[model samples]
Each structure stands twice: as C-alpha cells, then as structure tokens.
Target chain A: MKISVQADAFDPGAELNAFSAGAAGAGAVVSFSGVVRDEGGRLSGISIEHYPAMTGKAIGAIAAEAVERWDLSDALVIHRHGDLAPGEVIMMVATAARHRAAAFAAAEFLMDYLKSRAPFWKKEYHADGAEWVAAKDSDEDALGRWAG
Target chain B: MKISVQADAFDPGAELNAFSAGAAGAGAVVSFSGVVRDEGGRLSGISIEHYPAMTGKAIGAIAAEAVERWDLSDALVIHRHGDLAPGEVIMMVATAARHRAAAFAAAEFLMDYLKSRAPFWKKEYHADGAEWVAAKDSDEDALGRWAG
Candidate 1:
C-alpha cells in the first residue's frame, strides 16, 4: 500500500497502475477519485485545512486497516490539501485484488471511510458566502454502516 | 450514453473526460475497468463473441435505466470483442452524477446488468485445453439483487 498527502493534483490512473504493478495474479483493480465540483456553481471552490502530522498518520492508519480488511494485492491513496478550485481532483483511492468483489468493495470502503473519518476541514466557497463546511450529519450516518 | 463492442483497449481517463463533457453539472464521475488476468501462461488470448445488435442495445438500455435508478448525469459502456490477451482490458463502465452515490451505484449496476443480461460468449485458450466459458449461474444470482 502507498499513501500520499500533497498540495498538487495527481493522476489517479497512474497511481492505480502503480498499485497494480507486479500483480500478475490480480484479476481486478478498482479505484475512485473525488473531484472538486462547482455544484453547478452552487459552490465555487473549497479550501481544505489539516494538521500535516496528524492527518498523515490518520490517513495511513485508515489505509492500513483497509489493507487488512480486504484481500488486496496492492493499493494506492492520494489526497490533496491547501486550496482546490472547481474541477480539480481532491482525492483518489485505488485497490487491486484477485477478484472483482474484493477490489470493488475495498475501493468504495476506503472512500466511505475517508469521507467520514479523515479529519479535514473544508470551507466551501459559495456564491452566497463562504463557510466552514461541517461534516454532514448524513455523511456520519453513512459511515455508521462501515464502522459496525 | 455511449456503448460499443470493440477489439481495442480503452483509456478510462479519456472515456471519463468524454462522459463528463458538456455536463458542467456533473460533480462526481466514477469508473470501473475489468482486465484480463493471467489465468494461465499459455492463455495467449481468448475470443469474445456477443450478439452485436442486442448486446449494444441491452447495454444502452441498461445504462439508461441505471441513470434513472441512480439519477446519473451520463454513463458510458464499452466492452471488447474477438481476441484479447492477458493484461488487456475487457470492459469499462463509467458514470457521472451530481453526487458520489449516484455515480458509484450506477456504474456498479451497469456492470451487474451486463454480466447477467448481455449475451456474450467467451472461449478460453490454454496449454491444457480450450474451453468455452459461459456466464455463470452465480453471476445471474448476483444480478437478482439489482432487480429487487
């Protein structure tokens, strides 16, 4: 497994390919990229904040746990910090496994964990105003399924 | 929606770019690729046969239905025909939506529908022998949940 937190946008495909490298017996590789969107211009951009040390450790822990939970041949995770404009990719999660079930599940499972567990503050830039977007109660609710 | 049965491989990032084209409202785009695995060293290639007209129509129709079921903005379905060697990709499913849920669910649903409903025949070539591999009964079992 590999994890990186950076200020620059990264190629999710390349990251996924790197994860699946040397995985000859691997039958499936699944990945997800979280892109910054305008929300149809409902929101313009998002400024994310994080504590470098704790954030890195937290994310690493999540990736490690994911590796244990799934029969993954390999995995890659990349998440960006600092300011992100609309249409920029915010994060990516990729998994390679010997079967489709493990790959697909691990990819989604990681994203769900990231959205609800990763400690990052996102301030939404909106046409109306800018505000620190609190983690949604609904997002927390969604995370519950995985925790149990 | 774009549906094609090809002998060539595809780039997911490029296909994703096309899927999100002209759809500025798309906030999240999710994709999945199924590649050929090293089932055997002598597995030089395999020939994929499908009912061309019906397969394309079924996939398009399934994608259209998935868009409704998941409220997707756009979807693309591409699969291969003829001979495909190990390390070659077999199919790609991409979906764009206003949220991650719609994008993720729809892409998965499209895959389930294709695996069960599409009329595709696969013949495997190996050193020991050559055999025709039909879509499994368990694959049909897997699709049942989607209909419900």
Candidate 2:
C-alpha cells in the first residue's frame, strides 16, 4: 500500500501504470480519479488546505483497512492540495486483487472515506468572491453503505 | 462510447489518459482491468476465441446501455482475443460521469456483463494438456445484483 499527500501535480496515467506493475500476482485492478468540475463557468479555481500532521496518517489508516478487508494484493492513494484549476485531478485511488469484485469494492471504499471523512478543507473561487466548501449530504449518505 | 475487440496489445494507462481527456466535463472517472492470473504456476497460458461478426456489436450495445443508465459523459471497452500469457491483460472497461457513484456503478455493470454474457470462448493450457474454460457460477451470480 502507498499513500501520499502532496501539493505537486502528478500524472494519473503514469501513477496507474506504476501501481499495476508493482502488483505482481493480482489479476484485477480498479482505479478512481476525482476531478474539479467547471461548474458552468462560474468557478475559477479552488484552493485546498490540509492538516499536514494528521492527513497522511488518517488516509494511511483507512487504506490499510481497505487492504485487509478486501484481501488486496496492492493499493494506492494520492491526494493533491494547494491551488487547483478547473478540470485538474484532485485525488485518485487504485486497488488490486485476485478478483474484480474485490478490486472494485476496495477502490469504492477508499473513495467514500476520502470524500466524507478525510481532513481536507476546500475553498472555491468564483467571480464575485471565494467561499469555503462544505461536505455534501450525498457524500455522507454514500459513506453509510459501507458502515456495517 | 468506444468498443474494440482486437488481438493487439494496448496499454491501459495510455488508453485511460486519452479517455479522460475526451471526457471534458466529467468529475469522476472509474476504470477496471482484467488480467490473466498465473493460477499457482500450474497454468501455462490461455487462448481466447470470439465470433468476429458479433463481438464488436454486442460490446457496443452493452456499452451504450451503461452510458444511458449512468448518464455517463464517456465510456470505453476493449477486449483482446488470440493467445495470452499469464499476467497479460484480457479486457478493460472505463466510465466517466459527474459523480463517483454513477461512474463506479456503470463500470461494475459493464464488467459483470462482460464476464458472464460476452461471447468469448477460452481454452487454458496446462503442462499436460489444454481444456476449454467454462464460465464461473460466481460470475453469473454477480449479474443478478444489477437486474431490475
């Protein structure tokens, strides 16, 4: 498993290739990428802040749980912070397992945790002003499916 | 939507990058890749055969259904035929949408259909002899979850 919280821009395609290569014995791989939407041209960009000391540890713990639960051969998570323009990739998760079901489930599990529980603050910029974004009700609801 | 039934080997990462670029307004992108498992060193390789006239059309119809059901911004399906070595990729499916739930669901739906219903024949090679592989009951059961 690998987790990284960084401000630099990275290529999702390259990262996926590297992760798949490292997953030696796996027969299935799944990946999810979250991008910043343009929001009908009203949005300019977004700035993200993180609790540096706790973010990585928190994500690592969740990723480890996913690996154990799904019996994954490998897993990877990368989240970007700082300023991000519309259409830029904000975060990504990848999982590898012997079966497609396990790989897909693990990837979805990681994404749910990240979207709802990860310690990241986002501020969106518009033409008039910028405002802090709040957690969406849909995101919280999405997390509930895995609670049991 | 794009569907290809071919014998050529293609890079999954490169394909993903191109698909994401074309997705334009999507906020979530999900991908699943199926690879040939080594089967504990007992397996040598496998050869896949398909009905050339129907394979492409069948895949295209399923992909179109997924896009409509999930309201996808884009979708892609690629399946390779001919001989494949252990650890080689057999197929891939990708979906892009405005939300993660739709993207993940559509990708999984496509995979379930491909595994159970796609018109592909498989023959596995062993040290002593080769045998035609049959569809797994588990794969068939997986398709039930998506039914109305």
Candidate 3:
C-alpha cells in the first residue's frame, strides 16, 4: 500500500507502470484518474485545499479497508492539492489483485470514497469571480453503493 | 477508438499515457490490465492464438459499441497473442468519459466481452506437458450482465 498527498504534479503513466511492476504475483491491475474539467469557457482554473494533518490519514484508512476487503496484492492512491489548470490530473487510484473482479471493484471503491468523502475543498475560478465547489448529489449517490 | 491484436510485446503504461493525452475534454479515465499469472510452480508459460483476420475487427466492433452506449470520449483495446511468460501483460482496456461512472462501466464491459466473447485461444504449458485452457463459468457469467 502507498498513499501520497502532495501539491507537485505527478505522472500518472509513470506511477501506473511502477505500480504494476511492483505487484509481483498479481494478475489483474486497475487504475482510475480524475482530471480537472473545464465546464465551458467560463472556467479558468481551480484550487484545492486540504487539512494537511488529517488528509493523508483519512485516505490511508480507506485505502487499507479496500485492500483488506478485496484481498488486493497492492494498492496506490495519489492526490494533488493546490492550483490546477483544466486537463490537469487531480488524483489517481490503482489496485492489483489475483483476479480482475477484485482489482476493478477495489479501484472503483477507492475512487468513490475519494470523490465524496475525502477531506478536500475545491474552489473554481472564473472570469467574474471564484467560488467554492459544492459537493455533488450524484457523487454522494455514487458513494452510497459501496456502503455496507 | 483504437484496437490492436498483435503478437509483439507492448508497453501498457506507454499506451495508457498516449491514450489519455489524446482524450481531450474527458475528465475521467479508467484502465484495466491483465497479466499472465503463474498458477503454482508447475506452470511454465502460455501461448495465445487468435484469428488473424477476425480478431482486430471483432475487437473494434465491440469497442465502437461501448463508445456509443456509454457516450465515451475515447476507448482503447490491446491484446497480444503468442507465447507469454508469467507476469507479462496479456491484454488491456481503457475508457475515457466526462463522468467516472461511464468510464468505469465501459472499461468493464469491454473486458467482459474480451474475456468471454473474443476469439482467442490459450494453451498453458507445464513442466511435463501443455494443455488447452478452457473458458471459465465465471467469465461467461460476467458477460451475461452486459446482455441486452
């Protein structure tokens, strides 16, 4: 298991390759990447803020749960906080398991938790002004599927 | 959309990076990779065979269907045939969409089709002899979920 909460930009492709290489005995690998989207030409960029102390700990706990539940061989989560331009990757999750079902399920589970439950605040910038992005009802609904 | 059925080794990470770079306006990207698993110490390697003329066409058709059904920004599929050693990548599927749900669903759908419906044959080699690999009931059942 590996988790990183950093402001610096990371290469998703390079990280994925490294993760796959390190998963020695796994037969299936799944990855999900979330990129900042420009909703129309009105958007400029976005800024993400997090509680430094609690952010990593929270993500680590959820990732650990995913690993145990899915019997994953390995798992990785990387999230970026700070200013990000449209098309910039905001975060990524990867999972490895002996079977494809487990890997895919774990990756999806991690992504749902990160999107809806993670402690991150996002502010979207526009030409007129900037506003904090609100939690989406769709995201909340998506997260509900994973609830036990 | 891109589909390839080849015997030569390919870099999954490199391909993923290329695919993501080409997908403009997509906010979510998902990828699945299948690796050759060595079942215990008795297994040596495996050989995959495909119908040269129909393989690419079949994959392309399914990929196109996924893109239309899921409203995907892009989709990619790559499968390698011929002898493969343990830990080598056998195939990969990738999908990009404005939302994470569509991206994840399309990728999984592509994988299920590839696993059960794709025209590929496998022969697993052991220390003593080689035997033809048969389709699993689980894989068949997985495909049923996507049925119309």
Candidate 4:
C-alpha cells in the first residue's frame, strides 16, 4: 500500500500505470479520481489544507484497513493540497485484488473514509466569494453504508 | 462513449490517461481492469474468442444504457481477444460523472454486464490441458443487483 499527501500536482493515469505495474499478480484493478468541479461554472477554484503531520498517517491507516478487508494485492491513495483550479485532480484511490468486486469495494471504502474521516479542509472560491466547504450529510450517509 | 473489441494489446494506463483527459469537467472518474489470473500457478494462459460482428454492437448497447442510467459525462470499454498470458489485461471499463457514486456504479454495472452478457468465450489453459471457462453463478447474481 502507498499513500501520499502532497501539494504538487500528479497525473492520475501515470500513477495508475505505476500502481498496476507494481501489482502485477492481481487479476483486477479499480481506480477512482476526484476532480475539482466548476459547480455549474460558478466556481473559480478550490483551496485545500491538510495537517501535514497527521495526513499521511491517517490515510495510511485507512488504506491498511481496506487492504486487509478486501485482501488486496495492493492499494494506493494520493491527495493534493493547496489551491486547485476547476478540472484539476484533487485526490485519487486505487485498489487491486484477485477479483473485480474486491477491488471496487476497497476503492469505494477508501474514498468514503477520505471524504469523511481524513483530516482535510476545503474552501471553494467563486465569483461572489470563497466559502469553507462543510461535510455533507450525504457524505456521512455514504460512510454509514460501510460501518460494521 | 467508446467501445472496442480488439486483438491488439493496449496499455491500460495509457488508455485511462487518454480517457480521463477527454473527460474533463467531470468531478469523478472510475475505472476497472480485468487481468488474466494464473490460478495457483497451474494456469499457463487463457484464450478468448468473440463474435466480431456482434461484440462491438452488444457492448455499445450496454454502455449506452449505463451512460443514460448514470447520467455519465463519458464511458469507455475495451476488450482484447485471442491468446493472453497470465497477468495480461483482458478488458477494461471506465465511467465519468459529476459525483463518485454514479461513476463507480456505472463502471461496476458495465463490468457485471460484460461478464455475464458480452459475446465472448474464454478458455483457460493449464499444464494438463485447457478448459472452456463458464459463466459463474456469482456473475449472474451480480447482474441481478442492477435489475429494475
């Protein structure tokens, strides 16, 4: 498993290729990329902040849980901080397993944890002003589906 | 939407990159890749045969349904035929949408359909002999999840 919390932008496809190459023995691979959306063209950009000290550790633990739960051959999470323009990639998760179901489940599990549990703050900037994004009840509900 | 049934070996990562790049403005993108598994090191390789005339049309119809159902910004499916070594990619599906749920669901839906309904025949080759692979009951169950 691999986790990276960085300000530098990265290519999702390139990262995917690297992960797939490292996970050669796995029979299935699934990936999710979260991009900064324009919100019906009303948004200009988004700014993300993270606790550098805790970010990697928190994400790593989540990834570990997914790997164990799904018996994954490998897993990866990459999250970017700092200002990001619309259409930019903000975060990504990838999972590999012996079957497609496991791979897809693990990827979704990681994404849910990342949205609700990971220590990240986001602010969206639009024509009017910038606003701090709040945790959506829907996101919380999404998290609930995975609860034991 | 794009669907290809080919004999040529294509790079999954490269294809993903191209698809992602073209699917700009979408907030979420999901992808799944199926690789040939060695199965306890007993399998030598796998051979896949397809009805070339109907394969593309059938897959394209499935993809169209997913796009409409999920309100996808884009979708892609690629399947390779002929002989494939263990660890070689057999097929891939990708979906882009405004949210992660739709993207993930569409990708999974496409995969379930491809596994159970696509016009492809698979035969696994082992040290002893080769066996024609049959559709799993699990695959049928998986397809049922998306029924109306």
- Model 4 lDDT tens row, A1-148: 7888989999888898788877668989999998888777899999999998889889999999999999999999999999999878898999999889999999999999999889999999999999999889998999888889
Every candidate's fraction of true contacts kept comes to 0.42, 0.65, 0.66, 0.66
Worst 10 residues of 2 chain A by lDDT: A16-25
lDDT of 3: 0.91
DockQ of each: 0.50, 0.73, 0.72, 0.69
lDDT of 3 at A123: 98
Preferred candidate (TM-score higher): 1 or 3? 3
RMSD (CA, Å), each prediction: 2.0, 1.2, 1.2, 1.2
Candidate 1: docking tier:
medium
Residue-level lDDT tens digits of model 3 in A1-148:
8899999999999998899887758989999988888776677899999999989989999999999999999999999999999878899999999998999899999988888778999999999999999999988898878878
Worst 10 residues of 4 chain B by lDDT: B16-25
Per-residue lDDT tens digits of candidate 1, residues B1-148? 7888887777755665556543457767777777777765768678898897788788878988998888877788889988888877788887878777777778778878888788788898887778998777877787777766
Docking class of 3: medium
lDDT of 1 by residue, A80-141 (tens): 98899887778877777776777777777788878877777889998888999777787777
Per-prediction tally of clashes? 0, 0, 0, 0
C-alpha lDDT of candidate 2 relative to the true structure: 0.91
Quote the lDDT for B22 in model 4.
70
